[model samples]
Target chain A: AQSVTQLDSQVPVFEEAPVELRCNYSSSVSVYLFWYVQYPNQGLQLLLKYLSGSTLVESINGFEAEFNKSQTSFHLRKPSVHISDTAEYFCAASSGGYNKLIFGAGTRLAVHP
Target chain B: EPEVTQTPSHQVTQMGQEVILRCVPISNHLYFYWYRQILGQKVEFLVSFYNNEISEKSEIFDDQFSVERPDGSNFTLKIRSTKLEDSAMYFCASSDGQGMSIQYFGAGTRLSVL
Candidate 1:
């Protein structure tokens, strides 16, 4: 079945350290992928997304994701994470447009000062 | 910028009781959606509303779950006779349905069915 998968459940990193949150999805047809972040008591916030055209997508908050069709992966990365980046990150996918988003199990990124 | 709004950030109810979650999507958004996340689980899609009616729904959205846009501004999800297993964080989201439409989400309402 079509689904989103976050390989890591939790990632602990020191402030100013590089981090990567691996995500993979399986879809028989074309798909749109996204990265969403959720802080404590907050809703899921769109961090970045890849619809087409570009193989790499970036967010305003210094996070980037590379979409690899061959690997069925869209892994998020940050060269240097801050303490404020501590939160649960979700990877999601949809058939396209406004279709329902299938979310991954989520990866909790804890950046320590 | 406009954002989606959901009321009653947290709700506590007893099993077998009915509960209604309210949402006000962005005024110009053409698509509305509902999703839920059980504790420590992924966010699961419940239903999607467009043109004042349900355009899509998941198996988790059974007969007991219904959605409505009673007025021009409010979209509501009603759960008839809630169950203990129904406790989850309900999220309301909306999108303009334009090119590569992006869904914006509200903070969500944490429903605890005791």
Candidate 2:
């Protein structure tokens, strides 16, 4: 069985400050990781993913997540935050190309102006 | 870019009634799935369908749930009896079935059981 754990349930950050959302997973085999963002009343959108290659993956919107095999962690970070960035973030895992995706409880990001 | 779509953006039903949620995955995708998110909880997998059959399902998908691909393009999820706990946002998603391919999601149908 595979599972995802997000360290924080809520994070409040000031606009222009850097933010990091922590995630960890438990799996017996190799896994693919992903970060998804959901805005108010909108469906979730892929923020970034880690399938293979470089450990660091980045999204177009200044968000990035690094996959750490030893730590069993894939943490999402943004260099600077904006009020508009307030949303819910989910971390998910799919081990061995089986894409059933086990998701974390999600972190509620509240970017304050 | 092609995207997954779902119908009946919101549905209100009484307890013990049956409810069907419909989805139309991307035209070329091979894997379709249904997931749900209860208020203030993480999204949970319900079932996954491939080749017109269920490939995987979660414990939450018990006797009350069934999925069908009655047509080439339409995938439907039926619940035999609606419960208040079943009230949630049901999301329909699809993937290309390629190794590590990311799943695209629909806007989701808000199911409200009275």
- Each prediction's RMSD over C-alphas, in Å, is 0.9, 0.9
lDDT of 2 by residue, B2-22 (tens): 988899999999999999999
Query: Looking at candidate 2, what is the lDDT of residue B54?
Result: 91
lDDT of 2 by residue, A31-101 (tens): 99999889998887888999999999999989999999999999999999999999999999987343698
Candidate maximizing lDDT: 1
Output DockQ, candidate 2: 0.68
lDDT per residue (tens digit) for residues A2-111 in model 1: 79989999999999999999999999999999999999889999999999998999999899999999999999999999999999999999887779899999999999
Error of 2 at A96 (Å): 4.3
Q: For each predicted model, how many residue pairs clash, with residues at least 3 apart or on different chains?
A: 0, 0
Alpha carbon lDDT at B96, candidate 1? 90
Regions more than 4 Å wrong, model 2:
A96-98
Model 2 pairs whose backbones collide: none
